[model samples]
Target: MKVLHVITGLGIGGAEQQLRLLLRHLPVRSSVVTLTNPGAVAAGIEADGTPVTHLGMTGNRDLGALPRLARFVRQGRYDLVHTHLYRACVYGRTAARLAGVRRVIATEHSLGETQIEGRPLSAGTRALYLASERLGTSTVAVSPSVARRLAEWGVPPERIRIVPNGIETDRFAFDAGARRRTRQALGLPEDAHVVGGVGRLTPGKRFDRLVRAVASIPDARLLLVGEGEHRAELLRVAGECGAADRVLLAGACEDPPAAASAGPALPELLAAMDVFVSTSPDETFGLAVVEALAAGLPVLYVACPAVDDLAPEAAPGARRIGESVPELISALRGIRDARLARLPLPAAARRYDIARSAEQLMTLYDQAVHGTPLPAK
Candidate 1:
């Protein structure tokens, strides 16, 4: 079946990476449409043999994009239209309906209790989201917490499908050679205690807390991977915490082929670190947390209901911590001298394997198209 996937932008991010991974494993013909900013992830998707079309949407007020997208969707005659992220969902669903594509679906990749799209919640935004949601046949929630949040937001429970975000388990497996090479490349001592966090350097991520936490732990180094508008602010915060020299910012690792490799990419970076920590108060699904688990590293996270709702067996090395400098410092010191065991990946990680998720999504697509019930959980 032909499926048209729409997304707000093709920037390097969890949702973009997840889309790339899904396209690789999906069994049907697929193509992509990006509203704007066809960055590195778009190149990777094109390399994978999926065609990508960019709509040059200047801003949210660009109504012309609707007709253009609808025309493309109609010409493609796709069996399904799937949208990701917010702006794309709003526009794609409407375009798909205008194109007469009855099988429409969207994935809720980011949503938190207090924040929607990294901003404070507002009534107008809620109305727009709810109104656009009606144009789709189903909404895929990346975690159970996200599904619950959607239900609370007035989405019918039956319309929400719980499909967790996934990763390539084998790609992220720990490698000793990678650890050595990555540490050497980053100019970090091989024996230094490293605390790693991966995500956009945004205010909502609360990376400032991590900078302060690293400062309290003498000799502890911080490695933050990913980029955003908050880079300058993060640098200032690091300097204020007196951990500027101790912190290393690798910027955004966008190429999935390189990122998936054991070479000095994201996998190596994750392996080089002693532990992974996340201070973000919200997430629809914690992709980095799962990647860390797949790499056999212990994790400390705060306010991530996505991870908190997981069964213990799925992420055996995960530990919950608050987003405070004191708590993080204490946690770092507690794990400083301890030798962490590299355990087999948890069943929870396996459940979200990209290949498995793709197959389940195909099932959901069948249900959406033919009104068939999903197989028993």
Candidate 2:
């Protein structure tokens, strides 16, 4: 089937990377359209043989862009239109309907209490989201926690489908050679204890807390991967914590597949570290934590609904820590080599394999198009 994916911006984030990975596995013809900046992720998607269109949507007030998007949808004659992120979902749903596309799917990737996209959710925003959501055939929630949040936001429970995010299990599998090579390439000391985190360097991610926690551990070094506007502030916070030299930032991964490369990619960056950390209190799904688990690293996180909701037997490497500086410092100090080495490798792979998720999604797509009853969840 011919499918068109509409997304807010093709940037290197969890949702965008997930879309790229899905395209690699999907057996249908797919194209991408970004409502705003078509950044590095766009390049990666194009590299994978998919065409990406950039709609120069200047601002939220750009009403003219709506007709332009609808025109493209009509001209492309797409069999299905799938949208991702808040802005893209709202506008893409409306445009798809205007173009007379009957089968439209939108994925709610990041929705949390008190915030939608790093901003306080206002009444006007909710109204807009609800109004636009009504135009879609169905909504896909990245996690069960996200489905509950969507129900709380007035989306009918029947309209929501739970499709947990998937990770490339084989890509993140631990390698002794990778560890040695990545550490050497990134200039990490062979014997130093490393604490790593991955995500956009934003205020909401609570990276400042990580800096403070790193300062409390004498021998621990911090490595954060991802790019954002908060880099300067993070640097300042690291300086204030007196751990500037101990903290290393590798910006963002352009092509997520490269993350597993033996070079300076995210998976390699993850390999160079001894432990994984997540300070974000509001996470719809903790993709990074799962990737760390795939890599056999012990994880310490706070309020990660994705990891928390998993069966205890599925992810033994994850530990939920209290939300405090002292607690973080204690967790960092408590991580031992034996504990990290004993992570549940086989169970994690079985739980989060991308192939399984891709197959499930293709089934959902067929059900949406043919108006068939959903299989038992």
Candidate 3:
């Protein structure tokens, strides 16, 4: 069955990467469509020989692509239209319905209201999301917290499915050579402890906090590897912390994994790091957290809404910090190697790895198309 996965953009992100894994091994005819330009994820998908359709949409209100997309869906006669993120979910599902495709599934990737300009959606937008959730054939949540958040927002519990985010064990595996080369290239001191950090440089991510956390740790350096609107503020904060010299703000690493090797990439970044630090106080699924674990890195995460619940016992070294620099410093210094190795990957993580996630995505496609529950596996 032909399936069309819809998303806002093909940028390097968890959702896009998840789609890439699906495209790689979903075991069915599948394609990706982006309302925006084909970004990093698009490049990877195309390199893998997967078909990608872009609408060249620069803004959220671009409706010009709708007709073309509808026509394409009609002609392709795809069995399922899987939507990711909010904007694309609305457009894809609406267009799919108009194009006579009944199976429309949406994955909710965020737990928060997704508000803009310090405001929740206007009344009309609220109605629209509510209606869409009710009308959607199925809703998949990357974490139970996301599912709970959706339910709190009015989506029925039964309509939501919890599918934990995963990593590509093969691609995101441990690599020592790449790690060494990456460290060498970075010109890191022989004894400097590396801290691998991932995620957008945004407010919710609290990258500034991370910079501050490591400021007091002599000879410790942080490598932040993502981009967002908060760069200026982060830089200013880093400067104020007096630790800018010790920080390696590697802006927008396209593929940490690809840059080095299995280990050199994100896995390498994660594996190479003496510590994996997540200061993001509110993460939906904490994709990078799990990826760090998959790399067998010692993780130190601030207490977020969903963090403690994620393999709590295994991450016993995991400590929650309450808005204090001293607490952050304490948490960073607390993580030991033995505690990190104890964190066991839950069974649900199997479904997240590229291959397994791809298979589960195919199964979800089948369920979406046929109105049947996904197979138990």
The most accurate candidate by lDDT is 1
**Number of backbone-clashing residue pairs for each candidate, in the order shown:** 1, 0, 5
Off by over 4 Å in 3: 113-124, 256-264, 303-307, 314-319, 336-351, 371-377
Which is better, 1 or 3, measured by lDDT?
A: 1
| Per-residue lDDT of model 1, residues 205-252, tens digit only | 999889888988889999999999989988998888888899998888
Give candidate 3's whole-model lDDT: 0.70
How many collisions between residues are there in candidate 2? 0
- Give one digit per residue, the lDDT tens place, for model 3 in 172-209: 55566766777777677645777778888778777787
Model 1 accuracy (lDDT, Cα): 0.88
How high is the CA lDDT of each candidate model?
A: 0.88, 0.85, 0.70
* Model 3 poorest ten-residue lDDT run: 255-264
Model 2, CA-based lDDT: 0.85
Superior candidate under lDDT, 2 versus 3: 2
* Tens-digit per-residue lDDT, 25-112, candidate 2: 8899999999998987888888888999999999888888889999999999998999999999988999999999978999999998
Between 1 and 2, whose lDDT is larger?
Answer: 1
Candidates in order, TM-scores: namely 0.96, 0.96, 0.88
Where does candidate 1 stray beyond 4 Å? 258-263
Model 3 lDDT, residue 41, Cα = 74
